[model samples]
Target: MHHGAYPRSISNLPLLRSTVAPKRPIAHSPKSPPSTCRHYRQIPEEEYRRRLAEARPLLSNRRAKTLETIGTTKQHRTFILLCVAAAVVFYFANSQKVPVTGRRRFNFLSEDWLTIFGVSGDAYEQELRREGVRFAPKYDWRYARVMGVMQRLVPVSGQADKDWKVHVILDDGAANAFVTPDGHVFVFSGIINLCGNIDSLATVLGHEIAHNVATHSAERLSAAIIANLTSGSLFLLLGLLPGLTLAGLWTLTGGRYVQSLIYDLPMNRKQETEADYIGLMMMAEACYDPRHSIGFWERMKVVQSQSRGYEVPEMLSTHPSDGSRIEKLTQWLPEAMEKWQASDCHGGQGAIARQFRDALSHRRFMGVAWYIAVPGDWRLSIP
Candidate 1:
């Protein structure tokens, strides 16, 4: 007699209950990194937004959960499943073994493409020079010094001189330095100034040079291309899912999407480690103090700390911090020291002559020039 169906509205309301699936629980999506990296944008925000939008249509049907809304997005379970699938396919499709590390990797790359790209890269640099880029003798000194270092340390890459013509330019305001294939190295005057010494300069040069020897640059380019192609394919396939979020797509791809777009995962501390070992060897071979590496890395760490982690696009781009890099370098020190010593370090012998003798023993070169060269003899003459 009292209840009479409870006025229907009260029965249907049920406090804090579902009105169309309980507000969809706001859903529990994962916190995704930015849609792209900071390096990809010269102007940043506006340009980034523009590019993301252009790529958005690719993810058009994907759910759009921002970082704030991430907590409620329970949709990660589905994403995890898709991620597993993507991971399996990606691992198999891109896996490769590095010649140096002999470590198999999930990177899409090959030396053939590297050489091809090198041709174009060389062309591009020549164009820049043609467009009025001048080579300075001091920077040329930097180039020769760096090249000389590689020749002494990295026997495999030491002969880069034979095929790869070295180039250097002085960009006084440039805050960065980079190396291109075909032995072209660009150094900024600002970098030289900040170096404070040859050791600092050697550290920077060694890392860039290592990228070439390890084929890391080629690996980077391959990953970048694969990332784009895979992301584009994912964008299309995502429309088929229609319920997933953009953040969901990013994490599922294992940061490849951002890596492809903005380049976050391009060079982590791991690759930096590889460079450190290779670099130290090169420096030692050049008869420069391997101790310089420690100081150079320290300076970078100091600069990073002073900046309070607030720097430019590099912070948000491919690089890890100096602190992390220095720590990793520490781990490699004992091993690197052993290599330096095994090469007859401590000025006990001429590093170049020792290197040539070792090369001759390997039967790789008949007459090692640094040890066997005569001032008048252009070629090796047997007694």
Candidate 2:
């Protein structure tokens, strides 16, 4: 408010300031002109080296631990050696000879164990009843037809003393027949229709019976156990390698598929072939014409072609090809014919003998005798 002279309070007041600031010129040192580098606290060389040395051991320990987690070379070698030794011991311990074929194979299941826990015929029959599956009555023609052939084959099956029971299942969709080790035979209606005659039916029945006689089910179970162990071991071994895991191995290896292709399928095919051989011999010894087997297999081949529309390669299939079966049957026909001729089938009190007598009696008493035009064909005759 005062220009030159003012009031006492006004003269003692603080000075008024302007809003704008005045500019100043910058100065630079000659030796280090306008330094822009960041400043840091300096450390002593000895202290830094000591700290680095201490950290090296920690880093080394971490690296060693990671290596241990993935398994070292020595550990892997030791584990693999142990696996080989265990496998060798297991193989030798379970080695046994197959009946009839005399082929040595691995099966660790004992007879007592098989009896108690194995597939039981009586139990299976009860299960079928529970499931409401119908069985052909004993008085039915199919039942009699199956029984007649089975009776003739049983005496020569090497287990005649066993309480053998045959049931004809009313399933027309399943062209299959199977027998339990305890002498229970199940014949499907579809297979009966497929057989077309008793001799061909005998071929099918003899094959199924041979499976029981050979104890293939128990062998298959044992093989499954071995396969599981092998697969688990393989997965574990693969996971121990660097950058691998069980899930990864499963995805990459297709473990179950590999095991089936390598072990299970081949084993099944082998068992099937052996059963074919044994069944052929058994049918021949029972005085059923063995040559019918070849024709039956040819018919089976045609059926399979129509149903599946495409054939699976022999390597991938559980059973051998129909061609393979026919070839083997043809090769074995000479021996089968010799056995048939030696049976003296015309004079015995066997099922075939009874059938012959019935035929003759029908001709004499009824003045009419039905005969199958085909040599190996089956036909019913009443006396």
Candidate 3:
């Protein structure tokens, strides 16, 4: 109970003081309850500005991408405009008038260029010779007949001054005649048999001659060049599209087929019709009967019908159908007769010869009529 007990009691007094500490009550306001939901604090001005600054580059990149897309679209438009401009210039620059028919056409190849290209009959003849194609000798009747018809036709062909050469191919199976650009005429022996008369032979020779005078070969070559260029450009432009592949574009466009159907075959048929008109006029000018031309086409119809058993649609062929040719020839016959009557053939003995020739032509025409009427008579040869 003295001073030592006092020190021990002081240490115990700390432990007693810790265990008996008084607790204070938490204060609550009547206006608000303790919130169970989260409280959202507004972002500070500096923090908001810092986030905006960080996003600014992303917004600018999006604008740049939009501008780039607009620029690319403008470039594509400008390129298309340029191509159109070029095509317009090219069309006007190469425009020309076809001979005889006097129809407007597009031919960029000059005569010098055509000659240099060797698209002439002479070149074709040489090729034929190399291929061992037998040709009738000058002394042969078939060769003489072709030469005789050509001699009369050339003077009226408007290209009389050109070096004219005639060769009769010995192949009787090929019933065709063609003239080269450089004044070379090739006649198949089979065509002569089909003609059956001198006036009918004249029709064929005149047509071949008209082709040369019209410069059809040069026109064809020039057109081919243009068509190829157009198709190639189309292919390239179509290839630039996003979803289209090259193989898909090729299958879709079918450039060659399109060119053939839309351009080549149609153009060839047009040239053929033009040649027929020009040849009719030439034969009339040469004092040949134009009615015989109709007879010849009728015969051709019978032959074609018999051989193929089915007629090709006119659109699918390079030549006009026999019926079309006959119809046109009939339409043109009156004009040709007027020309023929104006010629020297109507004077003195020439008139008598024409009457006799016309009588023969009428007989031949009747034969063709009989053959056409008897559809069952397949045994009737054209000759």
Candidate 4:
């Protein structure tokens, strides 16, 4: 054929002409198998379908596993970042000093937070009422007596004009008392029954008031919130760790109860001691003999032993045991007495003592054995 006629015929033949065009060469390693040879090798349709069915499961499983691994890795990275952020927040938030004790502590609660959520004064009182906590009448003599003790103590706690209201809770046989963050005192009649005299009563009221003055309730709330956030975040972080199960995560984080028992309870006990010391000074400053605390706690020990069957060790208890409490009060007695003697309301205000004695007339054990107060003197001795 002529050269021009050959060219036209070649270009017109589609398959042969397209196959001859220059294209970029695919790179292949020298060690790679010769797969180019397999492109020419044809298998029967049934065999190809059989091979595809067998490989399909394996490929699907591998892709699923790869996706799961990537998702888990991303989840772990997110949790780690969250924990780091929480740690940074806690560090920057920092600590505060207690007003009453002048002791520094790890407290991150801001005044606004305390005002908004921490100080549930009226709310807590209403909650208690809803929970069947029978409150003594505001005009009741027992209530008045408790209020009297508070009146004498609050001013000395450096809380002048503090609208500190005392509400006497007459719970059945429960010797417990608590003060709210915004200065609402809930005194139990059982605690009054437990106390020997006005001074012992002063000890109870003063301690509860001191808890308010020091903002212990708010501090505890703040600590618990921070701990819960930290521990929960940390637990999520641990869950992301490779090969960790739910049980393993709990073991690693120690759970919320364990954290509260280890971190929060110990801190609570410390706050109790601080309140004790501050309360002792308050009672003394109010002209109530500090030594009466010994008799009061001794009676409490007897009551607790009879009721609770056994005392929880101080280290494990939220409040120091009766023995520890009495011992600590004893340690501060000297200082307390000095403050009492210097108090303008010194000598226990004989008229107030008379009213206290009259209020105690119903009790059969109202005698020197309960509280040994020297006539016309603030100094007290326990028999």
Candidate 5:
């Protein structure tokens, strides 16, 4: 991944992941009293540009050797060949294999490799989630309902249930949500503030899920390797085929490189749109109120506009602006809403809230009051 500035022209963007996941930098600050430090002189824009030009040569010269290592722009053509020759030799050299959706993933990543790339990460993350605050009661119900929807959808996606687990993280201040390649989900509490109801949340989840479903994580990692080994003239690496390295694959999903990829790398916009469409369809199938997606987005637009002079919106942090998203979502609303209503059969937007309210009425009375309210005699008896 290129350690560089965010590109104004995305083609030059780095294939790195985001450092801003679930966290954002404060956008507005009081103009610091003119910097009193000796090195704080403000240069004119023209002078700044001139200084940048002046520095470019020296910077380029310093970076000459490292640039040579990046190889060539079309990483796949040559690097893949080089890596493939190495991979084939490495493949038969060992009987290792990797698994996914219960099928063999990489012929080279066998039982030993799986054990090497084992549950350490998952166990640590589990501890982190447990140490985190528990979400409010209603949040649990929403999570269960959403997970149920994904449970139904993943099979439709042809993903194996035993192999892929669904997860939720309940951070109230977090406006973002993401799913790891292994199906661990992190949903921030701040997200609830941005979205109106289940459908909207579903839209967000669906987008992240789409990234995993499309194997975008894996592909992006390959792209990174290609981009990194940019100038290799090894034609044998071409058509070397998709081989997953246990270590490299995990790094792509879990490490800083992915942070660079999500935020800094030039994303395939078509994939983004495709995820929206597929996620929309999945939400509708789950009997959610798809129209809430519109309301939820409108709220985001409002929040973003208000934040303009104060803070940057989360949508812009990883996604396109609200105006374009709203328009695109609206374009597909008719078809999605039609399917949603049929699956719903009860009504629209209000129906989800009503269902949630009813669940609360039942659970509080049953799970709470029954367990806690009338236990005096029983408690005394037990004692």
Candidate 6:
């Protein structure tokens, strides 16, 4: 109580000893922590129990719901992935390689179906013939010449079932020619007039035939079917709204249209380029000058320029532009020349055929009578 000594007042009355100041409570340093844990320790047991009782059910329910949501999401993702895998397998299985170019393509549509659509049915060609003005006396020498060219090309094309035939639609104004999927060739007389030489005509013929040989039409049809089905299924799977509103409907349709334009059009343009390459080879093998392909496309460029509104940009159009076609042909000319020189038929025949075609194109005959009236030597002649 005083100086390091116990008070003697323990024996005496305790109040009688000198009064001692209560020891001051120790001051806390700034760096030292306060006894915060004491506040929690001071809480009553009954209150702690009550709080735990209130929180347990909520925590358990949240945990259960989170686990359930994760399970459901995994299930949905698994199903969507399985659907995509199946579609991929089906596509790979159905694809086939195109001849000459060896490009893999879809062809679920059968040749029988194509024949029914183009060959057996009187709808496509017959309807076209009926609607448009055609050159009469269909057996004219010009047609014969076209048919002759077809005969040469078909043998060289190496198509196993060669049922190729040419129908000369002598529409003097329509400068186009095309081959159907079923081997029906339509040659507009306008093209005949436009072709500067027989080789140029053969170039056009070979190109059209190459389109059929490559089976581009069937590929396009198959792609359209797959694209429609796939896009529809994807939107359905997504649960995207396809409602009465214009915006909803557009959302449903717009994706598919953009998808087709992005995927389909480029593929179509590639098919055109493939056909050009094969056609150049075919013409060369048939003893037609592949170099004249340049000339033909040069002529087409002139025609395309004159018919400005009729043309579309190469990126948008199915066919490559004339300049592109000519450039490609020029690039392949050396290879084509090798094939031409190796051919059994001499290229000189092209020159003579050009002369004969030039002369015959000038003559205007209304019927087969005039066709016969043409010199017999000229009809049978070959250089």
Identify the candidate with maximal TM-score: 3
The TM-score obtained by model 3 is 0.66
Clashing residue pair totals per candidate (backbone < 3 A):
9, 0, 0, 0, 28, 0
lDDT per residue as tens, model 6, 193-311? 88857898898888887766555666666676666556555544543233123336656779645654577667767777887888898899888889888888888788767756455
Cα-based lDDT at residue 184, candidate 5? 52
| Top-lDDT candidate index | 2
- Of the two candidates 1 and 6, the one with more favorable TM-score, higher being better, is 6
Flag regions of model 4 displaced more than 4 Å.
1-89, 97-103, 110-112, 236-254, 346-383
Tens-place lDDT digits, model 2, residues 65-177: 76556534567756865875686667665666565566777765533345665667778778777766778988888889998998777666654445678888887766677
How high a TM-score does candidate 5 get? 0.47
Per-residue accuracy of model 5 over 44-78 as CA lDDT, tens digit each: 99999988887746547557654543433466445
Between prediction 3 and prediction 4, the one with superior TM-score is 3
lDDT of 3 at 168: 80
- lDDT measured at residue 377 in model 3 versus the true structure, 0 to 100: 14
Which 10 successive residues of model 1 have the least lDDT summed? 1-10
- Candidate 3 per-residue lDDT over residues 251-301, each given as its tens digit: 678855665777677877777788888888878888889889999988878
Better model by lDDT: candidate 2 vs candidate 6: 2
TM-score of each: 0.53, 0.64, 0.66, 0.64, 0.47, 0.64
**Root-mean-square deviation of each candidate, in angstroms?**
22.1, 32.4, 37.5, 29.8, 17.9, 34.8
Better of 4 and 5 by TM-score: 4
Candidate 5: worst-modelled 10 consecutive residues by lDDT? 374-383
Which of candidates 1 and 2 is the stronger one according to lDDT? 2
How much lDDT does each candidate structure score? 0.49, 0.66, 0.63, 0.60, 0.46, 0.60
- Those runs of model 5 whose alpha carbons end farther than 4 Å from true positions after fitting are 1-139, 160-166, 232-264, 305-318, 338-383
Model 1 lDDT, full chain set: 0.49
